[model samples]
Each structure stands twice: as structure tokens, then as C-alpha cells.
Target chain A: MSLKKEGPDPKDWSGYTVGLNFGMSAIVGMLFGLWADSAFGTKPWGVLIGLFMGMVAGFRVMWQATMSNTEELGEKNQTENEAKKTDKTDV
Target chain B: MSLDPLHQFEIHKVYDLSLMGYDISLTNQSIWMLGTSLVLCLLMMVGSLKTAKVPSRMQGFVEVTIDFIQSMVKDTAGKEGLKLLPFVATVFLFIAALNLVGMIPGSFTSTSSLYINGALALTVFVLVWIIGLFKHGFKFFGMFCPAGTPILMMPLIVPLEIISFFARPATLTVRLAANMVAGHVLLKIFAFFCIAMGAFFAVPFIPLLAITALEIFVALLQAYIFTILTCVYLNDALHLH
Candidate 1:
């Protein structure tokens, strides 16, 4: 039952933040697309493009964040291993 | 007799003032924000005013909170993130204070409004944008591409990345504001049930108590989530990841 709080853990990042990003992007895209459709009278095509763009952005954010977290965890593990090796040498 | 759950959110002008073509009058929401911030500052300052080898409960609480925010910044933004600690700490404390105060019956919840949330979110949005550009110069655009993005796919990927960038503040604004509104509305409904049932109102009262406790947890959680996300975005600004 350790009460100590550590620096950012990959596990600490919740799916909700990611979901917030994805869901909002979709909404932003759809609404903006609709606005553009009316402005340009492009109607269906404008909205379709906007929705597609939003989905692309939303997925990309999730993908990029996951990729970066993986890289960060790998680096953290490498550092821990190195430190452990130094402790062994000292012992 | 009445259960208008959203009635709590209404703004009433205490001293209605029309300045030429503009309306700038004092409202309950404004007072709540001001009072919450003043009390928060006074307490945080007074709690740690005395330094001793043995800390009192107030001092201990203040120190722990400071440490928590400091570590959050360090963890999310790395070493350079320490520069934003004061700002991050202030934001967390202010929001948390408004939330706790709001829980007191009839007190206004300033943090529940989208206008307040939007302003705070936009400030973070602008601040991080400026910080990233200042720190990395033109290379700040590299944040959008991430690593290993092929040059040929830049056109398609770049726009998606840009849209995602815009989503940052929008999500931040929505998460906090929406949570507060939903929780308070539910609490109001349960409370209305508790009182309206009279002799049999105990059943509804129990759930109301539970919801009130849950609302408190949410207030703290929302503050924390908002602060940590700020740190994460600041990290992105500093490190371009």
C-alpha cells in the first residue's frame, strides 16, 4: 500500500480524454461542414467532406497519442534497466 | 412543488446597468467566481504561513496539494513544465474551490458555465500555442506530423492533425462544463424528490445524499483532469510530441 505518487504513468492516461478528443472533433467537423455547405451552397458534398475530415483527425489523435505513450514507456523501462545494472555493479 | 433542475443556472442581474450600448451588470455567477478565488487564495496562503519541523493539518494539506500539482506538471510536461506550475496550481485550486463552494446549498457554481470554461480553455489554447511557437519556432509545425509520417502523405495527414489540434481546447471546455451541468441537474432532481414526497421522502433523500457525495468527487476529479490535460498540452508545446 504505497501512497507515493509517481511521474506520468502511461496507465494513468484514461480513455475518456481520448474519447473527448475524438467525439469533439467529429462534432466540430460535422458542424463546420454544415456551415460551409450553407455558405457555399455545396450542400451534401461539403458536409460529407467535413465529416470525413473530422473522423480522420479524431482517429489520428488517438493513434498518435498511443504511439507516443509506447515510445515513452520504452524509454522509461530502458532507464530503469540501466539504473538496475548500475546497482548490481555497485553491489 | 416545482422541480426545475436547471433553474440554478439562471443569471439574475442584481443591479442592472446599461453602459451606452453594452450591458455589464453584476450577477451571482460573477460574485461566486470572485468569492471562490479570494477564499482559495487566502486559505492556501494562510495554511502554509507558518513553517515548522512539524506541520499542522492545514499546512500538511497545503503542502501535499502543492506537491501533487508540482509532480503532475513534472510528469506531464517533463522538467521544463515546472515553469507552468504556478499557473497550473492556481487553475486547479480556483476550479476546485468554486466546485466545493457550489456544493453549499444556494451557492452559485461559476465553473459550471460554458462561458467560464470556454474562456479558461481558450486561454490555455492561446497560451500553449504561443509557448510552442516561441520554444520551437517554425519547427512547432512538426508536432502535427508526429514521427515517421511520410512526406507524400503530409497533405492528407496534416489537415487531420490540424483539426485534432483545434479539438484540444474544445474537449477541455466540454468535459468540465458538461460534467458540472449534468451532475448538478441530477442532484436537483433527486433533491426535489426528497422534499416533495414528505413522509416517504427518506428514500429519495438517501440517493440525494449519495449523489451529493458523488458530485463532490466529480468536482475534484474535473479540476484534476483539467489541470493534468493542461500539463499534457504544455508538454506537447515544449517537446512537440
Candidate 2:
């Protein structure tokens, strides 16, 4: 119920983390590309997929990293506490 | 003075070593890392040497730092993480100090360099991976597949999870390096603009000064983010949900 009262705040760091992710993802993508190229006998195709995957991965982290914070930690703790209470009563 | 933002990325070969049919050049970056690590060692040694009922300024600073890191680890990684405090604190302070020190005139940010950030990120990545594996073995890989994931989604979800797992180091490296680079470059660019635009009005100095303070905040904030993320990763590894 309280979840609706509070949603994710606008973090100033939002886009920037994504930038970092893309950079690293590109490198990973390149490595993946090389493997794929060798395996598939396709020169740039694998690398292209790597690049795409890296971008997707980078954006994913950007989203996930934002979800991680003190507030979320608190929420998790609260949930755990509630679960424990239910277990104790049921037992 | 003319400004080239990417000038920071230029690497000059410090020394070339040839062994086993390979050429490796020790760089300005390698030196900076060595220097930062030494400074951190001396800092802790001196900080801990004179433990007193009433702390000296240096001792007090180190105590505050340790206490801060301790609380952070406890809060995030729980008591089990307390034993790893020294290593975590060392990494936090070393990276934070080095990142700040880079802001000084004529100093290069080791963190701004991809290789340096990569090394640090990879080290943390490897540590968490090893610890997670040691603690949970092959079961640690189960971390990717969440509890309620649909059975039909396993094929698509598994690969996504694997890719996500591999992406950690990349994210880590990029976060630190990019923040370092972006902040410094923005600071430099603004200062240059301030100097150039001064003939029209003194307003440029305001943003210049403001950006300087913001840079300091960014320096510390990025460091905290980097360290805290490290702790979170450690937590996930330890808990292995």
C-alpha cells in the first residue's frame, strides 16, 4: 500500500551511469564479436551483436543500480521481518 | 590556454620491458597507482600507530574513516562483512584519495584511464566472484535465476542473466572512469570558458567557482557510490539469493 505513496525519485546520476555501462559493454561486445566471428565465419556480425548486447547490458545495469539504495534496503528488511513474523505464528 | 578534453587520455610510455617475446610499457598510470597504494599504506600505518584515548588529528581522521566504512559495511553487507573491512576500506580510501588528488593542478586521474579502472573493477569483480563461489560453489550461479521466474522464460532469461553477470565488471569500470573523466573535463571546459567569456561580464566566474565545488562533491560522491556498490555486490555474493 505504501509502495504507491513512494516511487523512485529522479536521480541526478541516472543517465551518467548508463554512459559508463555503454563504454564497458562495448569492450565486452568486441570480445564476444571476435568469438562469434571465428565460430560463425562472419567477420563483423558477432562484433555487431556484442555491441548491441553490451548496450542492452549497460542500460540494464543503469536501471538496476538505481533500484539499489538505502530505501530499497529498508524495504527489503521490512519484508524480511514481516515474513519472519508469519513463519513464527505458523510454526 | 587551449583545451583539449581528451588530452587527459594521452599515454606516454614510461619504460618498455621486453620479456618472453612481449613488450610492456610502464606508464604514467602505473606510476600513479603505485604511488597511491604506497600513500594508502603509509596512511593506515601512521593512522594506527598512535592509538590513544584522545585521538590526534591524523588519528582522528583515520578513525572517522574506519568508523564510516565499518558502519557502511555493517549496514549493507551485515556483520559477516566486518572482517573484510580492512580490504574494503583500503580500496575505498585509495580510490577516493586518488580520485581527489587527480583534481589538483597538473595531476592525471588514474581512475580516468580505462586500464586503471578496469584493473580495480576486475579485482573487485574477481574477489566477489571467488568469495561467492567459495561460499556457495556452483550454486552461486543460481543468483541470476530469480525465485519466481517462469519455467517457460528460462531459455531467454538464463542467457540474459549470464550476460548481466558478466556485465558487472564493465559497469564497475565505466562508472568510476567515466565519472572521473566527465567531472574533470567539465571542470576544465568551464574554467576555460570562464576565462574566455570574462570580457563580457564576471558571471562566468560564478559558474566556474560553483563547478569547482560541484567537482569536489562529485569526486567524493563517485567514490562513495563506487565503494557502496562494491559492498552491495559483496552482499549479493554473500547472501546469494
Candidate 3:
């Protein structure tokens, strides 16, 4: 997460946006469906499908965020191990 | 006296300019936007006229502002995004100006309305899609499916990815517009309370001053967040990872 040793963490903001995107996706999907219902007179079915789709969209944001964080953790660990090995060699 | 805190949001048309049955009259919001752009342009143009190896105070301010946005873009979107520095900087300045100006009494905030922010977000939405398509050609469609997925799971993953992609602009729009509106409304309400308390106005005035100070910080933070978020979206388009 510390791409730079100096500045504040970038992941801090992105982590907050993860949950925000989930809420936004659900709202956007439901509103889109609501607009469609008004336009085409398809009330319940449109919403039903929209709800499922929105939920899936929200889950995707969470899943991708978690996956990326885990990947970063793995890389960080590898880098630390390599650093340790180099320190031992120097000693 | 009943004070209407939300009254500032009401747009009053200064001049009517209807062409092709479309109302394009200049409103309060448009005036503020134009004013913000003009002032910033003048500052940047005049401020940078005398370029120095070591910038003067004015030049330093302008240069630092540009550098800040440039660094944010480079950080999030990589070296390729440095090319988009001007556009990203313009957006940051534009939104920052609007937010700051709206803090002034009798100033209209262009960003408070979803009509404005929604359009801005939509433009980014279109821009990102266009950039992705132009860069990746037919392969841009693959963005809907994450890399290294099992073939059988593609069916479930693709639709979710598409929906999430579709939600990006909405999230951007909601975040900016909602923040501006909420801050302004809260400020107005507090100010009203402060004023209405004729005898004990000092008590409310203290909090009002604090909120005003906080709003300034918020203005800066929101601009940084918005710019960084834009860079992130651009990164997704460029890298699809």
C-alpha cells in the first residue's frame, strides 16, 4: 500500500470508494429500473430483475476490491521476505 | 422571519435565450461557473506570464496546483495518464472554484445540482468508454469479464461486471453533487439558526464559523478525491486490470 515511503496511503481513499460504489450501483440500477417502469408500463418485473442485477453489481465491487487487496498483501509479503534475505546476506 | 435555507439553489434566469425550443438562458449557476472559469483562467494566464527558474509566489501557487493534479493522475493512472493532466487539472480547478465560491454569500453553486454534476460525470463516462474502445478496439468488451476467470463462471461474472461498470458514473455523480448540496444546505441552516438567535447569536455563530472553516477543508478534499477518482477510472480503462 505504501507505494511511496513518504506520502499518505492511496489505498485509504480507494477502500472508502469500494463501499460507496456498492451503494451507488444499487441506487443506479434501481433508479434505471424505476425509470423503465414509468416509460414502458412494466412495473414489478422490471424492478425484480433490477434488484437482482443491482445486488450482483454491488457484490462484484466488493469481490474485486477484496481480490485486489489480497493480491497486494501477497506482493507486500514477498517483497518483505526478499528484503529480509538481502539484509541477512549483507550481515 | 422564516428563513428558507434551500432558496439559494433556486435558479433565476438573467436573460432568456431560446433557440430551437430549447431554453439556454444564462442562470445564476451558469454565471458562477463562467465567473469561476474566467477568474481561474486569468489567474493562470497572468500568473504564469513571467516564468522563472524559481517561481514567484503567484507562479508557485499556480504551478503547485497544476503539479498536484498531475502527480495524482500519474500516481493512479500511471505515466500514460500524465497526458491527461490538463483535463484532470481543469476539472479539479473547476469543481474547487465552484465549491469555494458557493461558500460566499449570494453565490450559486453549479455543482449543487445533479443536472450539472450528472452531465460532468456523464462526460467522463463517455470519455472513459471512448478511450477504452479506441485503445483496445474489440477487446474493450472483455473488460466486462475479469482476467483469469474459469470459462464456466464467465456467464455469472460478465453481467455483474457490466452492471458495476454502468454504476461508475452514477457513483461519481452522486458523490460530488450530494456532497456539495449537503454542505451548502447544512451551512445555510446553521447560518439561519445563528442569525435568528438575535440575542444569543454568538453561540450559534461560533459553530457557524467552525463549519465554514471545515467547509474550506472539505472543498479541498473533495477536489482531490474527485480528481483521484477520475484518475482511477481512467486507469481501469487503460489497464482493465
B184, model 3: CA deviation in Å? Answer: 1.4
lDDT of 2 at B159: 55
What does DockQ give for each predicted structure?
Answer: 0.41, 0.17, 0.36
Ranking by lDDT: 1, 3, 2
Error of 2 at B174 (Å): 1.0
Query: lDDT winner among the candidates?
Result: 1
Runs in model 2 with CA error above 4 Å? A1-34, A40-91, B14-26, B198-201
Of 2 and 3, the candidate ranking higher by DockQ: 3
> Weakest 10 consecutive residues, lDDT, candidate 2 chain A?
A1-10
lDDT of 1 by residue, B1-241 (tens): 3468888998888877678989878798987888788888888888889977798888888888888888878777888989989989988998888888888989888888988999998989998989988999999988878688889998888778777888888999999999999999999998888778899999999988899999999999899889888887887888875
Model 3: residues with Cα > 4 Å off, grouped in runs: A1-10, A31-43, A66-91
Q: Rate residue A64 of model 3 by lDDT.
A: 68
A19-90: candidate 1 lDDT, tens digit per residue: 788898887788778989999999898789888899888987788677777787799899999999999999
What i-RMS does each candidate reach, in Å? 3.2, 8.6, 5.1
Q: For model 2, what is the error of residue A47's alpha carbon versus the real structure, in angstroms, after optimal superposition?
A: 5.4
Which CAPRI tier for candidate 3?
acceptable
TM-score for each model: 0.85, 0.78, 0.87
Worst 10 residues of 3 chain A by lDDT: A1-10
